[model samples]
Target: MFLTPYVERLPYPSRTVQRAIGVAAVVTQAGIGVTGSVVRVTGSGLGCSTWPQCQPGSMVPVDHAQYQTVTQWIEFGNRLLTFVLFVAAVAAVLAAWRIVLDHPSRRRLVKLAWTLPGGIVLQAVVGGMTVLAKLEWWTVAIHFLVSTPLVWLAVLLLRAFNEGDEPPRPVVPPLARKLLVPLVVLMWLVLAAGTTVSGAGPHGGDPGTHRFQAPIETLAQIHGGLLVAYLVVLATFGLALMRGPVPAEVWRRYGAVWAVALAQGLLGSVQYALGVPEVLVALHVLGSALVIIATAALWCGSRDRGAPVSGTPAPRESGELTPAR
Candidate 1:
């Protein structure tokens, strides 16, 4: 009792403590993406027209004739989100530290979570360059794409934490499981294509920014083709899973993955047909996040059963069942 004040404390159970902080990193990361889209769609990409400082001779924005208040607020506010993301990342890093000895296998995850702060730093630098370069398509596109991967990493961290100190064991057969990795790769290829389509679309951050030379229709077609391929691959996996005597939870996650992919496709089509309305564009950005999360959940669910989850029979009411995260 006397040592309490001197000793640093770790949360009990280690598995479920402040887990919301890890998950919040996911949401805030996605939120930043959506808000960035808002900045692009609203043509406020160059609102500040400078970085590190909102304008010349001022770290904060000052009302100027060239840049209006609304645009400045949108762009600057979106930039401010990096701080929120940083705080969440720090929380995750701290949580990871407590569990390293208990879960040595999760060292990789701890390393990845540690990367978030550095990634945010790089994001800030890239963002500054984007400003100096007048929001060029590649710079803005690269910045957007960078955040997407960070979201995937954060998901991995959350899953690892959810599993706590449990050592990982294969949930499915080692042979049949090889299919999932390629499917995930396909998902990322499709996302990259979508970002490229975004770069070519009418919204390139600012009105005067350079755009991808390809016609919007052609970019949409390319994106659609990749998406269709990804869906087919994922659907094939789901069908194979269904044919086997797998756990009910696998089926549930499979169905969920399909639902999310289809919904994202529908959003893409509607947005294309409607000429990419601002509201739809923002929703589509959020949909990108949904697809990412679903795919991640499915993949993570596939990797390991550990104790019992995602392919395990439901426990009867008479029995106690601890979560096999």
Candidate 2:
């Protein structure tokens, strides 16, 4: 199952090769999410018009006067990209298998890697439901919601490869360490609220698709309020990191979190004011992916990952609490 037979047989894939695989997995995952937004915006959610097949009896597109060529191509093309995502996920698992098998600390990478393929399988099933249900708002919401955490998982896997097998040592002080998990939870809540808003908004995949009874403005306000709260908490944490004796790495990552959160908030405001243009909605989707990654990446930086044998991270010098996942 491994791909080393045609090449040199090393104990594990070189760090460089493994890192490349990590990048590939993330990009492919993000690509799928963005293309899904395209499917929504273009109203091509059912370009193929059937589940497990483009048409009733054919795996390919059939000429029909009802379905335009462009719409059919866009939808089918999105389906084709699923195979690309699957290939990337499988490659990730294979690339890191040997290390996972041999090293105790490295076993965590294997678990995270497994999620990539597993998530794709689940996403496939959900995609089938979306097609079968004619892109119902809840089905579509679940479809988008599934990708959000997978992005976090993909980010975590990438971080693990670089973090090494150090004992879970957290660098942030206890005073600061307590705030990180809440940020993650709040991020998810914001995502859920945003999805609720989208479900009630003008974009419903197909023209005649049913929408949630919730008020879009009410949902937008709730989503915006939650976003503000999150930003406030993050900003407070960032300021505390600056004044405190935190590591420079932590400061940089937290800064990135602040930046992404601010950008997303601004986009949300503009989209709402302009009546949620299709283009902005798509960008908002892209921004959501970035926010999840940035939040997860910031938490990752607080981890004092090092070789378990050596386990010599500098953060311990500051007497910070070492939190582990």
Most lDDT-accurate candidate: 2
What lDDT tens digits, residue by residue, belong to model 2 across residues 1-325?
3443422233346677778888888888988888888888888887888978988898878888788778888889999999999998987887566554344457788789999999999999999998899989999999999988788899988887777765778777765677887878889999999989999988887887889998888999999988988987787676656555778888888878878889999999999899889899889998999898889888888778774321222224464433322
Clash count for each candidate, listed in order shown:
1, 1
Off by over 4 Å in 2: 1-12, 101-105, 308-325
Point out the worst 10-residue segment of candidate 1 by lDDT: 307-316
Query: What's model 2's lDDT at 113?
Result: 92
Residue range 1-325, candidate 1, lDDT tens digits: 2433222254422334536866887887778889999999999988888988888887766789988889888889988888998999987776665444334455665686788887888878988998999988888888888888778777777776666335655465543367788888888888888888888888887889999887878878888999999888877786667555666666777788899899999999999888889999999999988888877877777766353121122334665432222
> TM-score for model 2?
0.89
lDDT of 2: 0.81
Error of 2 at 300 (Å): 0.6
> In model 2, how many backbone clashes occur?
1
